[model samples]
Target: MTTSHVPAGAHPNDGHAGPRVGLFVTCLVDLFRPTVGFATVALLERAGCRVEVPRHQTCCGQPAYNSGDRKEAAAIARQVIAAFDGYDHVVVPSGSCAGMLRVHYPSLFEDDPDWGPRAQDLAGRTHELTSFLVDVTGVQAVNDQRHDATVTYHDACSGLRELRVKAQPRQLLASVAGLTLLELPDTETCCGFGGTFCVKYPEISDRMVTEKAEMVASTGADTLLAGDLGCLMNLSGKLHRLGKAVSARHVAEVLAGMTDVPPIGAADGGDRR
Candidate 1:
């Protein structure tokens, strides 16, 4: 239950000067779900953003910080700040990481007179992907492709609780032609994969994910969509473990119409969409 420090009156960039965006590719998306990263770029580019992936960017340090390793967390935080220093706005596909950059970074540097203000400035300019699209860029919908399957959304803890990302992705999803968004039971509850929490307390994580899997099953949706891959993976793993049939996907993948890619449990068929 960490407190979020989103700046007051902060909103997404409105394509002012054709905003230059630095994509903060989270460690999970970078290592495991590169497709989400690619789809994020496609969505942003389609909305007329000049997107750049800062090569030096690394993890947002949420894991280290949550594990009580402030020193290591701050070190990684500095690396991220330095990597995207010149960009007009930082856009992250993962709500957890984006929340770290926008809410926790400033607090991490609060005692440093030199870095604190800079960190605050950086935090102020960052935006979660869907929020940036609907709020800043005024993106109504994507025009490239559409899916006809019923989809249920899972609101990852960080995005829903810290970044207030509930309606943004839904708004975008609604715009997709032929896509049906279904309501999941207990949509706001955590899927219990709090980064290392899943690894540390496998029993609890398994129980939570089992509950989430049941909710997804109740929806009768063919696809489960979430903004954060951590929650998606947790739920997806549990779905596989339970021999359930629902497929999991990142919100960017759905919004970008990359449904041609098989669902999470499917065999390694290459990206067809």
Candidate 2:
């Protein structure tokens, strides 16, 4: 993908004025769920942030790093670290990527004298999307159209276990007008889409997602929501494959009221819900 550069002054800091944020659009959201990216921009802008989508940014090296490919992982990690080096903070929509940036990057460079500290510094400033929205930006709610639908959220593994991104997205979702947040059974269980793990172990992935789908189905919610696209995609794919009627959406998409987009596998002219 060709990198798009945002000139230094492209995003003017008007809200907190702490640090201009380099919005890290993860590969999944970039390719499959562009609406999530747009919603993220809307939420951050609503929260008074100077958001910039740095074109040079790419994968967070989680897949490579998790597979024990340190050399390639470090190379990509270095590129990501350098791309957003001067930004005040790196805001990412996915918990997995945010955790990788905030947790793994520093470890990747721990032994290096120069890049190690740089990675640590970058890690220190990284914030998951909802965390930045509710905590850093102090945003209480979004002013989107009211949708009276019961929604349940799935906590992605890296974000929940590694980054502790549990309540932030829920809090933000609860604040959305006319939306009722429903509780899911065993909400914290892994959805089995651990990057390449699903591909490498298809059977296990299928079983995990099937169980997750069952939990989501039991909620009687019209919509199933989650922060990370990986979990959403996995659960949604299985749900679609099974011909279940529940619709799946990203938290940002719900909060931003961009529900006009069709659910997974629907035809272009088909109904969204």
Candidate 3:
């Protein structure tokens, strides 16, 4: 819904050298697919932003917070806030993680006057990767890598509903030379990988993902791309199990021309990985 690149500002300023951006590598990207984090760095640096990865970073605390453990969640939030407080802005590769920082962090510190303002400040400056690229830095294009396969995009729940990130990625993808952008039918629908939801209700999650995979296949896209790793993993895993050959990758990898890594949920013991 928002095409403005300012991250939190109504009018983004791209005139000076890029703002100092602290890159928060989400837990999934850190453990399962580190290439996405690197690709994010590639894109951010290309946008003229000076990016830094804090060494003391940990989980975004969404699991604990959602589980109703306010104490542990607040502790983790404070640590994360302290780690990146000096940066001009904080950018996250995953919308889920960015949503935690931007939407939930302030609430975590509501009773603490000292930390509440800091949390609000961090929230105001934090942005999802694609949003930051298109809105904050005004980057129109990245690397010139072209895919031979037709690619369709999936709108992850958090990025679509929480961040209102509908158009920025499609706008940037339009400029990818030789890359065919096929819009998936019902792209905004959830793929049922709601972090803990899939684990709590496997049958329901499987049914939802089955339909989502069917939608992806209906588009005849050889490659499936999305901003959130969770949704990509869910859909790609289902596609793999169904014996479908749809390849999946984070949008950042494609945009940065770093698609050499294995696609999400690649078949075990396969050369594609």
Report the lDDT tens digits of candidate 2 across residue range 1-273.
000121211233363564477989999999898989988886666565677899998799888898999999999999999988888778998999999999999999989999999999999889999887777777666654466788888989888888888888887677667788889988878989988999999999899999999989889887888899988888888888888778888888877667788865556677475
Backbone clashes in model 3, listed as residue pairs: 5-135, 5-136
Which run of 10 residues does model 2 get worst, by summed lDDT?
1-10
Candidate 3 residue-wise lDDT, 226-245, digit = tens: 99999988998999899887
Which ranges in model 3 have alpha carbons more than 4 Å from their true place? 1-17, 267-273
Clashes of each: 0, 1, 2
Q: Which of the two, 2 or 3, has more lDDT?
A: 3
Return the candidate ranking by TM-score, descending. 2, 1, 3
User: Higher-TM-score candidate among 1 and 3?
Assistant: 1
Measured on C-alpha atoms, candidate 3 has an lDDT of: 0.84
lDDT tens per residue, model 1, 116-188: 9889989998999999888787876666457787889999888888899999999888877788999998888
- Give the worst 10-residue stretch by lDDT in candidate 3: 1-10
The model with the greater lDDT, 1 or 2, is 1
Candidate 1 is scored at a TM of: 0.91
